[model samples]
Target: MSEPESENGAVHEAQWREVRYEYTPRLADILAHLRATIVVTTYQAGKLLVLGVHDGKLQISFLSFEQPMGVAVGSDRIAIGTRRQIHFLRAAHETAPHVEPHGMYDGCFVPRTSFYTGAIHGHDLAFGRDGLWVVNTLFSCLCTLHEAYSFVPRWRPRFVSQLIDEDRCHLNGLAMQDGRPKFVTVMAEADEAGGWRPNKATTGCVLDVDTNEVVVRGLCMPHSPRLRGDDLWVLNSGYGSIGKVDRAAGRYESVETMPGYTRGLAFAGQFAFVGISKIRETSVFGGVPIAEDRANLRCGIGVVDLVSGQTVAVFQFLSGVEEIFAVDVIPGMLCPLIAGASVDKQERDVWIVPQPGSGE
Candidate 1:
């Protein structure tokens, strides 16, 4: 019941939680055959979803963040993993307006930089070669962003030794690769404290950051590992599946199963969007298997078909969103928009010249 959203007329700046987004005209013909634009973060509806397409309809844009979990999409930049900060969004594209069959720019995306690092349960966000790599999950570790210190830990899951806040091993999910920090998804390699709250279903695994090992154990509550091209995609979220780890036969390969409780993951060519959720009866969603026969829980997005693993398209959400924690993919964006900050036309325009002709 919150839904505010306004920009050029600038009054209400952000409020979202009245979601109701549905898709499946083959998910708008697969976002008009991959012209792309599907951002989504929803850390339990603190919201930040874009999901575009213009004239033929289906827009759905919203911003307001606080719990907005992990999402990283660079090129024009966007980092977002809020709940203690790490905003950093850009991409105004010279004031945006050029529209028409692909001049493309209904896009806005505004925050320009935040990076606080307090709550520590930060979860995924990756840019690497050493820059914005946070998954600090209450210090199970993989941090970076300390120009004054709050984080800078780097990597830790060699069975998590120190730097404590005791989320022990709920170390969410992260996977970078060439830019570094290669793989991670935990729910239980348990060091203590919440000890992954009684193995949230199956003692999930998938560690392997250069053989620190645990290359895929009996996962069920995995989250997003994604590193496609030589494969390493994960999202076994308490058994709603979407696997693919095998790092030289350590085992994980499921690749498709979605009706709820999968966690966000993204990728475009050959597909794989994943991110389902909604099993809420709590005690951390009871005995898994997508909460067994609870009439098949379901929240949204499950495109999958990384070469025939199935689920061709879906976008369901039949109500004001419930869960969905990160799903990037904005390649060739179609109709993006953000403008928030109570928008006085994106903050009454500012100026800071010096890089088009330069000797200013």
Candidate 2:
């Protein structure tokens, strides 16, 4: 796919068949300035988009995945939660120069391993000190991957009476602090199967993972709880607002509101990158604040100035994609490529072997 030059420095258009997008010109500049690349997952479209800057232009690489949701980025690897498995890809910087359109990309991610999780409806993921943590939504608990079983249950809220695939509560979003799981966000504190749906709009909350206590409540389908230093930030998803939790007072303070339903969130330097999606008029998304202006909602990422509480730039999808689940930033990587798990020749033919005389 090719991108047209910025139209009067306002919009940069990129199109490939039905997948069309237009982004603010400054979006490319920000990525270039930070030397970072963005990875977005759209389960609705079955795609994982790697967006970066290449030779003064914005470049996007689309990779196929089945119902890709959560994304966890480590120093040299990335973990992606999909339909029934979690895929792990390791960065192979040595192969970067040899990728097609040589030398344009600085990072090449190759499939390293995968773990079958059996469609537990995993949401957010994080690499904690102990191991890879997954918010196993269907089971209403946090779990880790294990070779002998689908998943090893780590922790579940006290209110959950049993470990079952009932989705008693939509337990999603995890925040790790100092290498350990610290806080989590849940759609509701309900204890019965599908119990959260009735009052999901006003029953959302944040929980202190360590104490298993509800620290903040009365949220509107809150997601993406992130701890930046001492501040606990989250997306009041159903309401289309980004806010911070006042743990002591059990409240959430809105920082800024956007036009779309916010879900995925990431932080880099002084800005926050949030994934926004247009909600479908389904029973699950019917009565939310953002739904009031559903027609004006967008599907893409928004760049927010954390300090000034302003949305600085936006990259919007015009067609072929909707409902983004996760957003992650690959730091220090300007342009990157991912070899997806596909049967295509490009993925099958690629091989990585140690250099001559190097230890294997």
Candidate 3:
């Protein structure tokens, strides 16, 4: 049989796609209660969106980047994985005199540095014991960035034979448990080049890092595995739901079935923030349940109550944008932004690192 066609198949290479978005009035009320800012990456649209509520209205700020996918936010920094690089950014003071209409905060994420990792199909990113660990999908392995080299191979799914350009298993998501890489999601355990393409609609599984076993299976294109407390939460993308995995029972139970192709997963307090992408008629998403249902297809973020499993609020994108790869929450940051490389060189150089003599 002929090999299944890649979902991306020459669609974006020839041109650029535009993105436009709008959030509902309810989004402001929901964000006000949480008092946290959200960072979402849309690889398809090549943009990073920061969401917050300011001045009794919803603040949606965006920064342009090339195929921005994985996002991880720390107390003082934010990490974003793009097509060929990983960016490290610092928060622009939560409270400052320059705080503008965006909110009490300036909402700027000044680019501290970036790693040129090449095109490794960098997916989920997390700051682990070995520094910045990334899901290097192209090599079917997890890797960490190094100042002297491209990447340092961390671990690979047991089924993968050798590191190659082929995205054999399509390892896409990473989860950290107890400050270590715990579990990962893969489309399939195919050890051949482009082997995972045929199983895009099925054969998805979650691998437990400690035991190196497929803890859960029979998923439809899953992504974004996150460990919250003791629960392993994941976005079953093809099913358009955010759920938890029961390793002992081998059950994947749904906490909430969101609209669109659910992918990004982040949490704040008791609420779960999920990113949903408008399902395009591609080989990867065409026949999925989200596309079949048709009634609820939307591209935006869904805020759900973890305990009640109800969608509390939504920030919808009416047009221009259609896909999201990752989502992150900036805890305690009401308004935040990333200055990026576009900022003035002099302004970007404005930092205070004490010299040895200054200490005297």
- Top lDDT: which candidate number? 2
Ranking by lDDT: 2, 3, 1
Tens-digit lDDT string for candidate 2 (163-255): 999999899899999988899889898899998999888999899989999998899999999999899999999988998988878889999
> Any runs in candidate 3 off by more than 4 Å, and if so which?
1-19, 92-95, 99-103, 106-108, 294-296, 342-360
Global lDDT of model 3: 0.79
TM-score of 3: 0.87
Per-residue error for 36 in candidate 2, Å, reads 0.8
Q: Candidate 3 lDDT, tens digit per residue, 131-195?
A: 78899999999888888989999899888989898999899999998678999999887999978
TM-scores for candidates 1 onward, in order: 0.36, 0.94, 0.87
Model 3, residue pairs in steric clash: 19-320, 107-336, 107-337, 108-337, 109-337, 109-338, 109-339
Quality of model 2 by C-alpha lDDT:
0.86
Better of 2 and 3 by TM-score: 2
For residue 131, model 1's alpha carbon misses the true position, in angstroms, by 14
Q: Model 1 lDDT vs. the true structure?
A: 0.75
Q: How many residue pairs clash in each candidate?
A: 2, 0, 7
Clashing pairs in 2: none
